[model samples]
Target: MAYLTLFLTAFAAATLLPAYSEVMLGAMVTQDYSLWWLWFWATAGNTLGSVVNGVIGRQVDRFKEKRWFPVTEEQLEKARNRFNRYGQWSLLLGWMPLGGDALTLIGGVMRVPWLNFVVLVAIGKGVRYGFVLWLVLNTAGVPSESVPSP
Candidate 1:
């Protein structure tokens, strides 16, 4: 049940939807959820969300000719050039703010290889969750009682 909650939380957070899984994850860890489970579920959920983003982005080029399309031709061109410049390394930033989401979306817009997208996005989100769990576990050994029972 706790893992389910974290899964949904992580999934939604990964989307363009506004969310903050890190806080929820940290709180859960302090509350004594399994570190391994939380990390696995969160990473899985977040990566799935990014895949949604990438799939949505893949369709963008088809609609680009329409004036109603949100992205301008110039903008698309710039994004393509940037992706070309950075290669898959740019995907590592998917865990970051503003730029991170944009990177994910742009990856879709640029039609990044599916495998590359998954591998990189997973790594980025995994690192984020791992760090959060590490911080909780290593922070002077937090008292378990302070964290409410699960």
Candidate 2:
């Protein structure tokens, strides 16, 4: 159940929603949970959320190249060219704090390859979770064996 909650929190955080999945993971680490499972579920869930962002981006592209569309065709063209040259680099930023979600969505608009998306997202999210776990462990110290009763 805790794993599922962590997965959901991470997933929601990856989306446009304002969430702090890292805090949840950090708190869990202060408890006695298995670090490996927590990191895996968090990374997996966050990457899956970014996948949804990519799909939304693909759908956004279907909008006829109207003046009202958020990005001009020329701009999108430039992005596509850049993505072709950079391949998986931009995706590594997709796990960042503010701009990360937008990066994943743009990756889809630019028609980045799906396999590349998954792999880069996974790597980025894994690194992020690892960092969060490290911070929690370092700051929170080892988990206490028991909580004193009130």
Candidate 3:
């Protein structure tokens, strides 16, 4: 049950939504949930959310005709060029609070290789979850034997 909540929260947070999964992750860690399971579910959820961002980017042209999310073709082209030039570095920083979703979308729009995007996104998100796992494991009063070493 707790794992489900954590997964959903993490997934939503990865999207353009403003929710933060770290809070739930912290709480779960404090509760002594299995660290491995928690990390796996959180990573999976977050990655799926990021994939949604890519899908949206691919379909952005459809939305361009609508005023709801207006993006000029010129602007889109500029964003694509910028992403093409800087995408590798950008992937390294996608775990940051802002622009993560935009970065994923831009990568898709710029036609970055899917495998590379997945690898980079997984690394970024894994690092974030790994950090949170460390914090929770250390602070939750769980015995060291139960927690995986960083």
Please report the candidate that would top TM-score against the real structure: 1
lDDT of 3 by residue, 51-95 (tens): 778777777866877767767878888887778787566876667
| Residue-wise C-alpha lDDT for candidate 2, range 59-101, written one tens digit per residue | 8767846668877778777767766686668899888997788
The TM-scores of all predictions, comma-separated, are 0.88, 0.83, 0.84
Please write out the lDDT profile of model 1 over residues 33-139, one tens digit for every residue.
66778899999988888888888888887898998998899988898898889987899889886777778888998878899999999999999888887787678
For model 1, the stretches where C-alpha displacement exceeds 4 angstroms are: 144-150
- Residue 138 CA displacement from its true place in model 1, Å: 3.1
Local distance difference test scores for all models: 0.83, 0.83, 0.79
Backbone clash pairs in model 3 (N, Cα, C under 3 Å; residues 3+ apart or in different chains), count = 0
How many residue pairs clash (N, CA or C atoms closer than 3 angstroms) in each of the candidate models, in the order given?
0, 0, 0
Model 3 local distance difference test score:
0.79
